[model samples]
Target: SVEELRKLLSDKDAYENYLHSIEEVKQLDTLRNDLRKRNVTLARHNLGKESEMAELRNQCMIIRTTELATAQEKFLDAQRREKEILARSSPASILNKLQEAANAADDESESLHRKLLSGELKVPEFLQKYRQQRVLYHRRTLLRLAA
Candidate 1:
């Protein structure tokens, strides 16, 4: 009988301490569940963002391979064309062309005179065309000399 009575009187604050502990444990469990839900939501959002980033990276690679490569090739072709044009536009080449043009103009005037004498060309037409060809020859000669 005395053992039972001593157990009943063992610590007057035990009941109050147990109740407080239970409340604290309930609050902690609720907080843990809320944190778990938040973590799941954040993980899903992170996964979505990572997938979007990967897709964007893939598109960039496609553009780099196709569009950028095409543009680079076009640029190279343009550079080659420019080099060819520059080569053909050298001073010596320009001077030679002017001399050839003068010769051609002189030959054309001679042909017109021959045609006039042969009666293949009318007098007024022959005069006009011959004068134009002679003027062109003189102009080409002047240009060739200047060059």
Candidate 2:
């Protein structure tokens, strides 16, 4: 009877251990499932970020291309205007024209001064003509300086 009782106790202990192992296995399976869900969420988040970054890069490239085209068009327009100006008047010819106008103004001023001194022109008329000649001469001089 003692041997039989010992054997019965041993069977009870083995059954308890088997139940504990089953519980541990269930806990491990729950943890594995949680880790799998987290991995899926992280993968989705990474994909969204990658797509957003790609769209932003494309937008930046488009903006840069538009700006480059506008700048190139402006450069070409400036070049065309420069060519037209050069064709119409060379710098040397422009300077010569200004010089001739200045000389003519000086000659007219001298004639007006002579007429005033000789009493051939009235004082008011001489003053008016002298003022006009002086203004013309000054304008031509300023133009030459700017050129």
Candidate 3:
């Protein structure tokens, strides 16, 4: 109202204070709106960054799974080759191992006998161990006969 404006104008101090307060409120509102806009922009940028991070993570997992599968295949192939190589060894090698086992059993039997003679082992224990060694020695000899 023009008349109301004139009344406020009659008091210069009141009019000026009221105008200054209104200007301050308008500036504050503008600042709040700008801040809100900036917040929205930052949220959009963060969403884009999150999607990029997820893509990179997926790529890394794909690479890792492929590499692990390749490694597993190589490991299995090496194991198969090792088994084949061992199986291909000559019969002479098998005969030598059987003969060595027989000799070791004979030596263990002799040691047990000596322990029995020296009274270091009980007669029952010596008999059991000596019987076991003799059986092992005969079994190894039978295995070598086939070789």
> lDDT for every model?
0.89, 0.90, 0.91
Model 3 TM-score is: 0.42
**Each model's TM-score?**
0.50, 0.40, 0.42
The residue pairs in collision within model 3 are none
Give the Cα-based TM-score of candidate 1 against the true structure. Answer: 0.50
- On lDDT, the leading prediction is 3
Residue-level lDDT for 120 in candidate 2? 97
By summed lDDT, which 10 consecutive residues of candidate 2 come out lowest? Answer: 14-23
Specify the highest-TM-score model's number.
1
Runs with alpha carbons beyond 4 Å of true place in candidate 2: 1-88
Off-target runs (Cα >4 Å) in candidate 1 are 1-29, 44-56, 63-97, 116-128
Better of 1 and 3 by lDDT: 3
Q: Total backbone clashes of model 1?
A: 0
Error of 2 at 125 (Å): 0.4
Compared with the true structure, what per-residue lDDT tens digits does model 2 show for residues 23-131?
7777987899999999999999999899899999999999999999999999999999998889659988789889899989989999999999999999999999999
Q: Whole-model lDDT, candidate 1?
A: 0.89
Q: After superposition, how far is residue 105 of candidate 2 from its true place, in Å?
A: 0.5
The candidate 1 region of ten consecutive residues with least summed lDDT is 11-20
lDDT of 1 by residue, 17-36 (tens): 55457877879878999999
